[model samples]
Target chain A: MYMSVAELVDAAKKTKKPIYELVIEQEMDTSHNTREEIWDAMGRNLDIMAAAVKKGAEGEGVFSKTGLTGGEAVKIKNYRSAKKTLSGDLMMQAVQNAVSTNEVNSSMGVICATPTAGSSGTLPGVIFTLKDRLDLTRDQMIQFLFTAGGFGMVLANNAGIAGATGGCQAEVGSASAMGAAAAVELAGGTPEQSAEALAMAISNLLGLVCDPVAGLVELPCVKRNAIGVGNALISADMALAGCTNKIPADEVVAAMDKVGKGLPSTLRETGLGGLAATPTGVRMKEKIFGKAVDAKA
Target chain B: MTVNYKSVFDIIGPIMIGPSSSHTAGACAIGRAANSIFQETPTDIVVHYYESFAQTHKGHGTDYAIISGILGFEPDDSRVPYAIGLARDQGINITFIEEPEDSPINHPNTAIIELTNSKDGKKVTVAGCSIGGGTIEIRGIKMNGFDIKPKGPLPILLVPGSEVDQQNVTDQLTALTKVNEKKQYQSAKGDLFEYDLDRRLKPEEVKELAKNNTNLVYL
Candidate 1:
């Protein structure tokens, strides 16, 4: 089985199979399960993600318990319908889908944690929004997830995908990278281009911290997911357009790990510093919980 | 080295209800494993939270998730939010111990639960950690006076920890079923015994096999 993005791309090119098929083979070797079983499970996850998207886009999204993130997706939807937006229909749809997924997650609705719950919105967001635009089939959508999962596995093995161990760079940043790589493959780009897409996406979001206000996965988390999808889409386009990444995907992941290690714990989901320590952030926490809280509490 | 991600599902999805997967869904899995390991509903449970969990568990619903798990609620269940009230209604006493930030356990999302059964007053302690992405690892378990590092899912039979014949246990287990692997671990607490077998044993089959050996306890 491949352990790095370089090896994954090499294997994909050598075997003359898509990256998703290679990933499926890896799963078969490890789990001893048939391909159909694995595909059915992934199909279920897609259905869940689609359901959450529909639920979120239907109304002024349900406000989170902390009242930090909600209704942004619906607002964007309305804006797209009523006015000429610079982002265009496809990009706006991607942004809205991403925000809606995170909004559903914040409201305690069921969601598939794509790499992580904190960054769950990116892959499905880009995939579902472009499904019609790309004229993709249901199998193609599942293949998209498999390709993303393959890239995410590479990052997780080389670096990590957790905000606690790494930073927001590892969570949302890795998700964006995974999405970009899958988008490249789905768009019929070469395996080399997919790896380059990964490198581009990650480099764009390097050193981002994970300072959720009040330690809740709302606030900047939801909006960051929207930005993450945008980053993934643009990076995918850049890779498909034949832009070469100076740094390789594997080295970029290692660099992200190093940057994550350099960040203080306060900037890594502890809520002890960064935006969580801001005056307005503290006031919002007190207003929600009816008392001031210590950063170390 | 720490992860065992075998499939696409391990990375892309767990399909759970969540505000935070590390805190909520992963915590629920640990608690659910604890519930199953104890083999009965606990009359009382004491949980200890450490590091990031100690500080932000309330906001992330980590506590709610674990309690709901003890109450046999799935990670995706809607009843998770009201688990505390449900526990009280069932006459289950729950206590939480939040460790100081500096005196925390190694992992940021870690918990140790002590559960006591009502009828026999038997107790078990399970130490687990949520290692992010709605995944968990149960590090150690102390039950029936034995320390077991069970590597597999429940319906396991744990033998009491004593300076007993490892060869004898292996022989007996092999006689009962095909033993895949036998391993011994030494921790600061004491020695732990573990076995990976070719097949999972039913509780009744475990009892039948252990009828002559009083030290074996079905877990």
Candidate 2:
């Protein structure tokens, strides 16, 4: 199996196939499943993602059980409609969708975990936004998932994807890198360009810790997904514009792994550091769960 | 250590109801794995949460997730949010205990569940950890004084009963698919034969094996 971005890009180039096609071929070989079965499974995931985006962006805002996160996505949508946004419609739409998906997740709604649930919003945000802007076909959108999953596999294997294991750098950071790489491919950029996008995205989010407020996937987690989409979009555009990273994608992934490991346990989803330890955060946790429970780092 | 991500889906999806994959989906998956070994709905359960799970389970809906999974609900099942009520309706009693954060545990997200079957008065203890990305590792199982620790991520089959013919079951499984690993443990209650297979056994295959081995109480 291809273990690194270099290997994946090399195989894609040699076979004269896009990264998504190579990913599909590898999945077929490893799973021993028919191509139709694999494609149909991903199609199901796409349906879930689309449904979540629609529910979050258009439906009445859903509140989390904790009452910590809700309505922000709708607020953004209304704001973008009423006022001119500084980031333009595309970026704001992605940001809206990203926050919306995370809100849905925080409310215990069904979502396809793009690498992981905490980081699920970024990919769907980028994908659905591209669909609206690029008028991408259903198959192309599924291809976007495959391309993203391809790069995600590399990061997951080489570095990590769990917030508890490697902080938010591994969760939302990896998701952003995957989204950026997939965006490059969806825009018809070369594998090398995809790698550059992936590298740039990871480098940008390096050392981003995982400190969810109130030990819930709310607060900064939802907003961070919005930021992740913005980062991915900018990185993809830069790669498409011929920008490259001094550090390779694989090395960046390795660097993220190192940085994540070096981070204190308090910063790695323990809810004991960062914003989670803020007085308001601690008070919120007490109000929701009672003060008797000591939230250990 | 590399995870050897086998499929694109492993990275892209595990369509689930979630606030957190590790806390909710992975916790549910661990419950499902334990339920599979239990072979039936448990009448009573006591779950011990450790470290991170102890700290954040309520916010993540991990209690509901695990209960729904033990009720045979998938991670994405809509019934998950109502699992507590459903469990109560089914006359299943559940108690949750939070272990101290300083408890000596290998993983931060860990749960040790003890399941009791009212009909047979059988008790099984399962210890599992959420390693992340909606994935779980069944670290150990304790049944009738025998402890079984599985080593890898491969699909596992357990055949537990009195005087189970290990060779016959192994032969049957070998005929159906490759067995990567096998262990046989003898306890006062029965002989527990476990096999780690190359892939998950199909329902028909499981049925065929059980039909052939009368002593195979769990598969």
Which candidate leads the pack in TM-score? Answer: 2
For candidate 1, lDDT tens digit of each residue in A1-297? 568898999998899999999999988765556789888989999999998888788867767887788888899889999999897889999998999899999988899998888888888789998797899999999999999999888887678777876889988999999999999999999999999999999999999998888888887889889889999999999999999889988889899989988888888777767888899888777776657455437
List candidate 2 segments past 4 Å from native: A294-297, B1-4, B101-105, B159-193, B197-219
Model 2 lDDT per residue over A119-189, tens place: 99999999999999999999999999999999998898788788887899899999999999999999999
Off by over 4 Å in 1: A292-296, B102-105, B148-182, B185-192, B195-219
lDDT of 2 by residue, B80-166 (tens): 888989998989999999887553347778898889988899898888887678877676888777888776354667777544466
Indicate the docking level reached by candidate 1: acceptable
The DockQ scores of all candidates, in the order shown, are: 0.48, 0.59
Q: Candidate 1: what is its chain A TM-score?
A: 0.98
DockQ of prediction 1: 0.48
> Candidate 2 at A27: error in angstroms?
2.1
lDDT of 2: 0.85
